[model samples]
Target chain A: MEHTWDFAAILANWRVLWVGLQGTLIVFAATVTLGLGGGLLVGVCRYAKTPLLRLPSMAFVEVFRNTPVLVQIIWFYYAFPILTGIEVNPFLAAVLGISLNTMAFSAEIYRAGIQSIEPGQWEAGRALGMAYQQTLRRIILPVAIKRILPALTNRGIEVFKMSTLASVVAYVETLNQAKLIADLNFNPIESYTAVALIFFAVLYPAVQGTYILERMLRKSE
Target chain B: MEWNFWAVMTDFDLLLLGLVNTLKVTALALLFGVPLGLCLAVLRLSGARLVSAAAAFIIEFFRTTPPLVQLFWFFFALPILIDVRMTPFIASIVTFSIQSSAFFAEIFRGGIQSIDQGQWEGGKAIGMTYAQSMRRIVLPQAVKRMIPAFMERSIELLKTTTLVSTVAYTDLMFQANDLAQKTFRPLEVYTVVALMYFALIFALSQLSIAVEHRLAKSGDSTVR
Candidate 1:
């Protein structure tokens, strides 16, 4: 018995897939913004020696880092509306969930970056009579950003891939769309192979760019 | 606000069973992944360009894509391609093992490369073949160096086991979702599940840190 592969079913679903791809990009963009913004705050807390700032931040990072993103997304989507009297659609819920998860990871990366800066740099800032916050903004942050860019970019890519978990919560991302197309056409091979290649096309360059950036940074150092 | 923990947990046994399934799959995936990954790592460093290139491509392909997509492909497409049906549990295990192997292979490669070049030279000086050197001289040390990372990877695998629930594999997350739907207590059910996961991962991570410290201490002793 010979079975021929037909991509006709998959090709027909291109419009749905395009919408799903837009959903994926939108979620990725939103989460990256929210995650990085929140991560900076959390990372600052991590840099603080006070238990007030550090303890809660540490707990937040550990809790998010340790749990599955799927569980987090699902939990957040279902739990958010219940806990708060407000209702959120799946897209918003997923964005919040992924952002918090990404925030934890990003904070950890940022903490590592902050810690990597020589202590003398801090003292040097102090000797210049810079306010603590100013010193952090002016001196520590620039160096930390430079030091952490590669690792941070890698984590960003993880967030990009992980955004696919939104599909499980009924958000129609690329994977969700592909699953739909496959289920409809009963043709998983063509549908998913196309999905995989699309992902590869998007992610490969980012991965390569990280390597390149890291090398360039190292050479300068 | 009335929090009925009891109400949500009415199907406690199902949840417990799910927890058991989660651990069972995690352990199974780890057992399958680590050794296979070690081989893949060695194969990549075997000085055979074609073999190494194939391994690299496969690893990159697996790494770049989300595991959820891979799981879906294995669950759905593989049966069609092979003309053999696999249970969701089997598909989950197979997918996780393949995915972890790619990650672990990279970790093994990094650990191996980080070893001092002098170690390899010393092995060669001792009239040992490359395989013998890796097995006898290099691997033991690399394994030790890689243990903390191995633990981290295992923890990641454990967390990833939650994905099986999406395929209705009866993992802890599946049970919690089931409980949530049954009781109309999504918040309560998932909270409990999340707490359980947090405690388990936290404890394991602390243990990893302790083991890492011990490994570092032992390395220092050999210096003395």
Candidate 2:
């Protein structure tokens, strides 16, 4: 095949792609914050002794962790409205699906981190008259969070990649915009290639940094 | 609105066919991915610097890019570039095989590296070549440790097959789209399909956990 590659069309549609890039960033920022923050709460609940807190949190983690994110997104976009008499837009659906899924996955990571801490640390906190929440906040979580930084970073990377799944429901993200560019210019090669490069360019450095973080953490511990 | 699951049940066969296709693609991808991953892992650990560097680049490139983008590249772009007809099934298989291989390669590397140096030296003492040692001694041990990680990645690959639905492949998710449009029951159809996926995936996850526990009990140190 002697096809000449032309990236000029993709370059010409930079404005369209830029808007999509902004949408992608917004979704990423929203979901990553919500996901990780909610994950901590769910993680603590999963660790709680009360069945009321622990059972529901366990179920939440299992269901969200096991199911495909795309399925969750589609369900939210299509079914949630009918079930609740509430309308769901593309952005809200995407945010709910991605963030909840991230929450489930990261909850497990946080739980593992907490479990890895020595019992003595908890005892010392109680000895100092710290309540459960205070111990979790001031001492246990501070240490647990550091130990699980790499795992949490990996989850964050997955969240960024998952934001593209928003495009499935007609959300105007990078891949959706790339699809538009491909359709407009008959340049799938350049359009899709650009999107792939954009993701790789953004994530490759983060992944490398994770390796460095892991090694440093290992040495310190 | 009323919940009418019977509307979905009437078209359950379509969803079942979709589920079959989903598993088919996942199985095929694993068939290709595991061996390819082994090759990449070995190449990344090769004695030659350039060869190892090239392998590392491929692994990182695929690892970092989203599988959805890779699918579109193969389905829409590669055919034009290579002058070959691209089917959704082919594009899906090709994309996932390579994409999952990158992940599996890391598992293989970690599993291989986790082996003690004495094992390799013992292989050398027995006058075994590097390839022989890897094939006969090191890999046997490494693969046992890799089982949990391998299953986890496979489950991930299974979930990822949903992307094929975007390219109009009649996977479970795609079938749900069709049935919902046909029946005007997006709520029931999608809900049913989600449950179906949940059932399948949850079973697999429980099975993996069981295997991990058994491996741990057997005193085999498994890699994640």
Candidate 3:
């Protein structure tokens, strides 16, 4: 089959693409916020001595990290309503799904970071007369966060990319919006290529930025 | 909601079928992917600049892009580029193999590079050709170094197989979607599916730990 490439059609719908971009950004922002918070809690919980908290947190991380995000998104979108009798919008469902998935990965990253701190740091904190909470909040978290910033940034990029999966559940993110346009126009290549470019535009910079930030952090150290 | 053992059990058959398909895809992908990865790794490590650059480009392109996009491109976009049709399963296998190969290449390269330069010199001094040295001595040691990374990559590939459903391939996640839509019990069905995945990955991780421990014990005396 011979076909002419139509740059005009894609450019004509640039507004729609922008709207889709907004949706993608929203999901990325929401997932990062919720994921960081949830991941920190889960990470700290894993280090907790209490079996009640640690066991469940361990199970949560295992389940989320093992399964695919598509399954998790569908499960949350469909199962959440049935189990709770409250219907969640597709966007919210996508946010929650990505957040939970990112939490699992971030939890592991945090654990690795926290474990990397020298035992002497803890001893020194105690020597300085800081309480456990104070040491964790003021000293330990700062050091651990600095050490893990590179990994966390990498995880953030991952979360940004995985947000594309949200399109599967009918969330009008960039990819889903592209799919809709493709279906309507029967031009899958143009639509998806546009979406791919948009995603690259967003993601590539974040990844590059992370590397730069990591180098800067190392230099300051 | 009330517990429905019979209903859940009846659906168990379909779930099992899905599990089989999941394993089939995972196994087939790995079968093709690992060797392709090793080849790419070797090529990348080749003393020739052109070969290394080409291999590096292939690895970087796949590694940086999202797998779902790669899947869509292979399944949908590539057919448009080339005048040929491929089945979803075929497309999935090809795409995943290519993607996994990139990861495997990096892992293998790291393993191979970690070996001391003295080892290579030692093999060459014994009158072994480069290929012979790599095959008989270097590769075996590299494989030992690579086992942990290999296990981790396998788990990653297995988890990534869930993305196959995006192209309308019927794997465990697809079955879970279908069952959830039919039974309207997304939470329970997905919970079960997630649990199965967790069980498999957890087992693989345990197996990896055991292998690493065994290798460490045997290789302790050889440490420099």
Q: Where does candidate 1 stray beyond 4 Å? A: B220-224
lDDT minimum window of 10 residues, candidate 2 chain B: B215-224
Find the 10 residues in a row with the least total lDDT in model 3 chain B: B215-224
Q: Which ten residues in a row have the lowest lDDT in candidate 3 chain A?
A: A196-205
Give the alpha carbon lDDT tens digit for every residue of B1-224 in model 3. Answer: 65454554679888888888889999999999999999999999999999999998777667666778778877877777678777889889998999999999999998888888988999999999999989988888888878878988898898889999878788888887788778866677887887777788788878877877887778721222
What are the per-residue Cα lDDT tens digits for candidate 1 across B1-224? 46789875567888888889999999888888888898889888879899999888888888898888888888877887787778988999899999999999998998888788999999999899988989888888777788888888899899888889878899999988888998888888999899889888889999998888888787821211
Top candidate by lDDT = 2
Please give, as one word, the docking class of candidate 3: medium
lDDT of 3 by residue, A52-105 (tens): 989999989987887767777877787778778888889878887889989999
lDDT scores in order:
0.87, 0.96, 0.83
Per-residue lDDT of model 2, residues A103-191, tens digit only: 99999999999999999999999999999999999999999999999999999999999999999999999999999999989999999
- Runs in model 2 with CA error above 4 Å? none
- CA error at residue A18 for candidate 1, angstroms: 1.4
RMSD of 2: 0.9
